[model samples]
Target: MKLLLVEDDRSVATAVSAILTQHGFEVVHARTGGAALQALLSNGVDSFDVILLDVGLPDHDGYEVCGKIRRRTETPVIMVTARSDVRSRIHGLNRGADDYVVKPYNTGELIARIHAVSRRNVPPSGGEVRHESELQFGGVRIELTARRVSVAGTAVHLTRKEFDLLALLAQRPGIVFRREQIISEVWESRWDGAERTLEVHVASLRSKLRASALIEVVRGVGYRLRAPSA
Candidate 1:
């Protein structure tokens, strides 16, 4: 698949390019945000299958570029950054990026994220999904169609994975889901790293819920959605 890589650091770019190329991807490298935008706009539909965007661009902030691209296209943008904080990840998702990866990322993990994002962006076939209206509990509502969550009439931002995890837990309420299961449902992949991703995502969800509580972690087991008020 053809990929647009927007990175200014030459050494880092070289390393990433080699890795991606080794994995059977034809990468179009761009050193500046302007050049990246130019390449994207100039190339036709089949030119690029995905974009690996560096958050710290020499010419412009990756978020700004992401916002612009989001306005024009539905191409998946996977953000690569050194910022590992949840806030940074949240910011990238808010700007329309499909996935986030920190700098010094594992090539395998990056590939997995790419595949997961690609799967998500794949348009649904034929007819549409006729599903439930929403999931409501403890003043929190999840709009399935809009893919949004609101707490007590206020919107609470959540990453795509976070929403998926929440939905899975919500569906079964008190039923515990193993970390491996959570990973499969949310990341669209099997267990890796002893389920650190599941743990991290749960922490993020807890933070978002703040005062309005739900979602419990069963020690040495898994997590379940249980009303905190209960």
Candidate 2:
């Protein structure tokens, strides 16, 4: 797989690129946000399998780069930066990143996340109500077969996790899905940090749908998708 490493620091980029290359990835090193964008422009949209972007770029912030990438392609993006705060993570996800990995991360875990985001075809099956080929929540349309979503007749791009979360909620509208249940089904993990990731995806979904009330939050409990009215 081709992986793009966008980091201004040459030393860090070199190390990461070398490591990824050793792990059987074709690593492309980009030193700045502009260079990264240029790489994509030169190679076309589907050239790279995954992009590892740094937040503190010399030319443009990573979040800005991520947004630009989303407008062009659905390639998986993993924000790799020193900023580990919850706000920064949320901001990156909101900008359309597939995952967030803080600096000094474990090589094994980084590799795992790279593969996780790259495997976008797999769907999550939890203990929620089973869904058919399509589901509707007012103006939002979900195509489970194709893993596609649209809002008010307009196609909307959703990251892998975002689609999984929405699909889970839409399985049985009006059924309150517990937080643990969501993480287990959508993420297939019992990791403690997954709860926060769930929250970020939910916020992203709500914003993209433009129907704040479509997904009802059961405070101190979980969330449920509102069923269409008669």
Per-residue lDDT tens digits for candidate 2, residues 49-143, read 78899999988988999999989888889999889899999999999999999988987578768756865622233322444799887899999
lDDT score of residue 134 within candidate 1: 88
Give the per-residue lDDT of model 1 (tens digit) for 21-135. Answer: 6554578999988998888778853356678999999889999998987777787899999999999999999999999998788776676576457556642232111135687
What value does the lDDT take at residue 22 in candidate 2? 54
Error of 1 at 60 (Å): 0.8
Q: Model 2, stretches more than 4 Å misplaced?
A: 121-230
TM-score of 2: 0.54
Backbone clash pairs for candidate 2 read none
